[model samples]
Target: MTSQTTLIVASPSAAGRHYECRRHVTCAMDDAWWKSSRHRMSQVIKCRFLPPARRKRLAAAGTEYWKSQARKYCDFCKCWLADNKISVSFHENGKRHKENVKKHISQLSKRSAKEFKQKEKLDDEMKKMEKAAMAAYLKDIQNNADLTSQELNDILSNGEGSSKLVLVPAPEKVPVWHEVKSESGNYYWNTETNETTWDCPEVYLSLAEQEEQKLKKQENEKAKERLKQEQQKDVYKEVNARLAREKMKEKAVKQPELIKNKSTYTSTFGPAERATKPYGSWTPVVNKPQEKVDLQLPKSSKEPIPVPVVYEPETPRIEFNEKKVESLGEGPVEFKKRKFNNHIKRNMRQKTDDD
Candidate 1:
C-alpha cells in the first residue's frame, strides 16, 4: 500500500484578497471579558513597603519603584503598578486600594493626636515645676523683707524709748562675730559658733559682737604696722643684693691680674704636682726661687762609663715525632683551585648505573 501527497498553490486573484480570522466580536467587547483580559494581562506586584514585608525587604529594592524609568507606585496601597494611565485608573477604582487609602489616613490622624497629647502633658508638667519654683522665690523674698525691717529698727534708735531695746531681748552670751570686707562681698564670721555668712547677724550690737569689733580694729592697726615693717625689710634686702652684685663685678675684673702675678714654675714642686685649679676653687700659689744644679767634671782622666750586659731567654721549639708520621700520600689530597664561574647551570643529571 503506497500513500500519495499533493501540494496546491493559490491563484494570483486569491493572493490580492485579504483573509481575516474572526472571533466572537461581541463577546470580546463585553465588560466581563475585558475585566478578565485586564486581570490576565496585568502583573500583581507585591509591595515591599508594607509593614509586614518591610523588615525582610531591602531599602534599595523599594527605591527602585520610585525611579523615573520604573513602574508607577501607589502611596496609599504601598504597591507598584504598571506605568500606563489605564492601569493607574483601574488600580485607583478598586475597592482594596480605596480601603487601604482610608486606613492610611486614619493611622496618620491617630499618630498626630498621640503626639499632640504627649506635648500637652509635657507642657503641663513644666508649668507645674515653674509655679513651684516661683512660690519658693516669693517665700525667700518675704523672709528678706522681714530681715530688712528688723535692720531698719536697729539703725533708727531713740534715747530710752528705742525700738531696738523693746524688740530685741537683753543680751545673753551671743556668739562673737567679725565682719571682713572683700571685693566679692562682705562676709561675717561667728567666733563662738564657728559659722560664716554673707548676711548680717540679727543681733548686731550684742556685748560679744562689740568686743569682737574692738579686737578687729586693733588687729587691723597691727597688720598695717607689720606691712610697713615688711616693706622696710624688702628695701634693705634689695640694697644688699645690689651691693653684692657690684662687689662680684669688681672681683671678676681683678681676677686675671692676680693670676698673671703668680709664678708658673717653683723649685719645691714639679709642674704636674702644682697644677693650677679653676677660679672657683683656686688655691693660693707661693713664689719660690728656682735652684740650679752644679755639674762637677772628672778632673784629669776620663773614665769610660760601664754599660750593663743583659741576657734574654730563648723560645722553646716544637718538633713532631718521625714514628707518628704515616705514608706521605695517606694524608688529605690537595685538588687544583678553579676560578669562580659567573653563571652556574643546574641541569638534570643523566641517569647513570649508580643512580
Candidate 2:
C-alpha cells in the first residue's frame, strides 16, 4: 500500500479531466508560494539567519562547488551579516565598518609598497650578480684565448726551427741511483737498470749527484760551524755567570766592612764638648767624693703596738646539681609545649581589621 492514494476512473470522462487539471494548478501555485516565502525569509535580518564569521567549512569535491560557497561575511568588520541589499548597505555605511575598511586598505597599501621596494632591491642585486658573472666569464675566455695563442706560437716556432739543422744539445739525464738504508744495512738502488744490491754502484756519478753531494757537504759544514758557535756561546755565558758571582761575593764582603766603618748612633756629648775633643778622642773624667750628711732615724716607741684587722667579702656561687634535676628522656617532655605564634596571630588580626 502506497501512502499516496490515486483516484481511478473507468473511462475518459470530462469530470476526470477537469479534476486532473485542477490538481496540477493547485500544485503549481503551492510550489510558487513556497519559493516566495523562502526568499522573503532569507532577506530578513535575523540573528539565526546569520552564520558565524569564523565558521570552518569542509572542502567541497570540486573548485566550482567551493567557489559557490560565498557566505555573507565582512572581512574588514570581521562579522557575518544578512546577504541582502538592505543589511549589506547598512553595514557598509556604519562608522566602525568604514574605519575598519580604511585601516585594511591603508595596511594593504603599505604592505604593497614594502613588497615593491624589496622586489626592486632583489632586482638590483640580481643585475649586479649577472654583470659580475658576465665579466668573469669574459675574463676567463680572454685568458683561455691568450693561452691558446701562446701555445700556437710556440708550435710554429718549433716547426720553423725544425727546417734548419741547428746544433741543439741533448737534455741531461738524471741519475736514478739512490742509497736506501734499512735495519739490515744500506742498499743501493739503480732504477734505470732495475737493480738492487748491497754494494755501491760502480757507475760514474751524474752531474746532479755531484751537485747534490756538494750541497750536502756545505750543509754539514754549516751545521758544524753552528754547533761550534753554540758551544762557544755556552762557554762565554758560563764565564760571565762565574764573573758575576765573584763580583757579587766581593760586594757582599765589602758591604759589611763599609757598614762597620760608618757609625749609625749619635754621640752623647754636646757640641762644645765635641769641639774640645774634635780629634775623635775623649778622656774619662773623675769627680771628687762629697762629704756624707749623717741623719738620725726616728726611734719607735717601746709601748706595744696594736694591729688592726681588715675584713674581705666572699662571692656567692650558683651550682646546678645534676642529681637534683629530673631525667630527660629521648623525646620531649610532656610539659614542654610549643610556644604560640603571636606574630601570625597579629598579622591575621591586622588583615581582618583592614578587610
Candidate 3:
C-alpha cells in the first residue's frame, strides 16, 4: 500500500519539538525554509495551474461573456434589446431593417429650416433688385425728359416744388419736471410723474415755462459760441484796442506826477523855442538889474590912530618856605595847572560843576 502525506507549516519563531505523524508531516514555515525548498514547490504549482494557450482562451471567453451581457440600442429603429434578441434579429428579416434604410435616405434628402429661411431671404433680395431696376428705369426716363437749367438748379438745391427733399430740423426736446417743496424749504425738480399738490394750476405751467426758458438759454449760449468763433478772425483788432485803453488808463493812474511834470516842462520849454535857439545853446537865460546900492562908511570924530601899550617887566619874586616832602604810594602822579586860552574856555570852566 502507498502512504499519503499532508504538509504542515509553522513559523520559526515558535519554540517546540517537531511532531511526527503517520499521515501528515509538519515543518517550520520560516523565510529560511521558503528559500530552501518551499519556494520552488510554489513555482512548480503555479506553472501547473494555467498554460499560455489556456490563458489566451480564458481571456477571449471572458470578453465574449461580457459582450453577451451588454445592453444594445438601435438608434434608427429607436429600440433596445438584449444580446439574444440582437442575434435573433440579425438572423431574421424584418420591417425594422427596411425602416432603417429609409430613415437614412430621408435624412440625406431632407432640407433644414435654416436653408429654407436662407432661400426665402434670397427671394426677398431678388424682389428688391427687381423694384430697384424698375425705379432706375423710371429715373432714367425722367432724366432724359426735357428740363430747364432753372429746374435743374432747383432740384440740386432742393428748392420748393422740386422732387428733391429738404429735411426739417428737429425741434429741441426739453424735459418736463415737477416741482416739489421739501421739508428743508428748498424746491427740487422731480422727473417722475406725480399728482399735483398745489392749489393753482399756474404753478405747474410756470415750471414748464421755466424749463423751456432754460432750454432757450442753452440754445442762446450755443449760438453765442458760434458767433464768437466767427468773430475770431478779427480778434486782434479788439484785443489791441482793449490793451491800448488799459495801458492809457494804467499810465494815467500810476504816473500822474510824471505826466504833469512832462506837460509843464514841455509848455515852459517847448519845441518851438528850442528850434529857434542856436544849435549849441539849449538853456534860456533872463537878465535882471539890482534894485538898490548904498556906498556908506562908518563916521569917526577923530582920525583913528594906532597905539602901542608898553609895560615894565614884573620884578622876579623869590620866597623861600619850609618844603614838606609827602610820601605817597609808588605810582605816576599828576599836577593841575591853570590855562587861559580864550574867553570861551574861561566861560566853559566857570559853567562846569564838579561832582
Candidate 4:
C-alpha cells in the first residue's frame, strides 16, 4: 500500500505549470487540504454570486460613481448608458420588464388615489364629529338652569317664544283732574260738577314716554320735510349751475376777449344780448327808382297802317293712316267692319225741270 497527500490550489493559477500526481485521492474532512479547499470555494462562490438587495445597492453605487466619472459607456458591459443610469440593456426590451414597469406605474397611481380618498374621508369624519360635539354641548347647556327648553327650541328651530319673566312695567293709576283757573290765586277741588276751565290733562301718556314719543314724531316729520326741501333745492341748484357753466363755456369759446373782462357786467351781458337779437339792423336797405313818362299813348299816324307782319308759332303736323293700325299683342284680335257711302246728287237736274 502507498500513502498519498492531496494538494489544494489557494490563489489564482500561478504560472500555468502541470505537476505529477501519484494518486487521485479524496481528502478527509479534518484534513488541511479539505479545509483550504473549502475556504477557497467559499471565497469563489462569494465573489461569483450576490444577494438581490446587495446587488441593487452595488448597482446604485456604481451608477453614482459612473455619473461622477462622466463616462458615456458602461465599464463592465461595454454598452452605452444614459446619464440618468437607465439600463440600456436587452432586458429593457423584454416583455417581462415592460410589464413590471407598467405595474409599478399603476401601483403608484393607485396609492396616490387611495391616499387622497382617505384624506377626504378623514375630513368628512372630522366635520361630522365636530357637529356632534357641538350638538351635545348645546344640549348640555340647555339642560342647565341658565337656559330653558323653550329658549333652546326657539334658538334651534328659529322659532319665537315668550320669555319666562315679563320686562314691561304695570300701568300707572289715572291722575285726578281739576278745573282751576290761572287767574284764581287759590286752588279749589270741585266734587259735584268736576268741570273747570284749566288743569285738564292734555295727554294721558306718562311724562317721560310722552315727551320721547312727541320728540320722535316731531323729529321724524321735520326730517322728512327737510329732506324733501333739500332734494328740490339740489335739483334747482344743479340746473341753474349747469346752465351758468354752459353759458360761461359758450362765451369763452365764441368770444375769448370777453372772458378777460368777465367780472364787468358790460362784458358779460353785452355780447350775449347782442348775439341773441335779430340781424336786421346790420342789413343794408335799397330804394326803388320811379319810371319815365312813357305811359301816355302815341298820336295816330296819317298814312294808312301797313298790315302787321306777325310770325305765328308753327304747329306740329300729325298724319294718321288706317292701313298702318295694328291689334293688341297679348289677347285675341277682334275686327269691326266699316260702312261706305254709295249715293251721289247732281245740280243740273233742277234747270232741266224748269225749262
Query: Candidate 3 has which clashing residue pairs, if any?
Result: 10-29
For model 1, residues 234-300, the per-residue Cα lDDT tens digits are 7556555655765897899999999999987566855556447645685789999999887986576
Candidate 1 error regions (>4 Å):
1-69, 145-355
Give lDDT tens digits, candidate 3, residues 50-151: 223433554565421111134456566666555466564783357776778787777766756668889999798667656655554565567775445557
- Model 3 is weakest, by summed lDDT over 10 consecutive residues, at 43-52
Worst 10 residues of 2 by lDDT: 15-24
Model 3, stretches more than 4 Å misplaced?
A: 1-69, 82-94, 103-134, 137-355
**Clashes within 3 Å, all models in order:** 0, 0, 1, 0
Query: Can you write out model 2's per-residue Cα lDDT over 152-227, one digit (the tens) per residue?
Result: 7898888963666779999876557776655546656676775555456666454467679899989999999999
Give the poorly placed runs of model 2, Cα more than 4 Å off.
1-71, 146-355
Question: Could you say which candidate leads in lDDT?
Answer: 1
lDDT of each: 0.58, 0.58, 0.53, 0.51
* Residue 295 accuracy (lDDT) in model 1: 90
Sort all candidates by lDDT, best to worst.
1, 2, 3, 4
Best by TM-score: 2
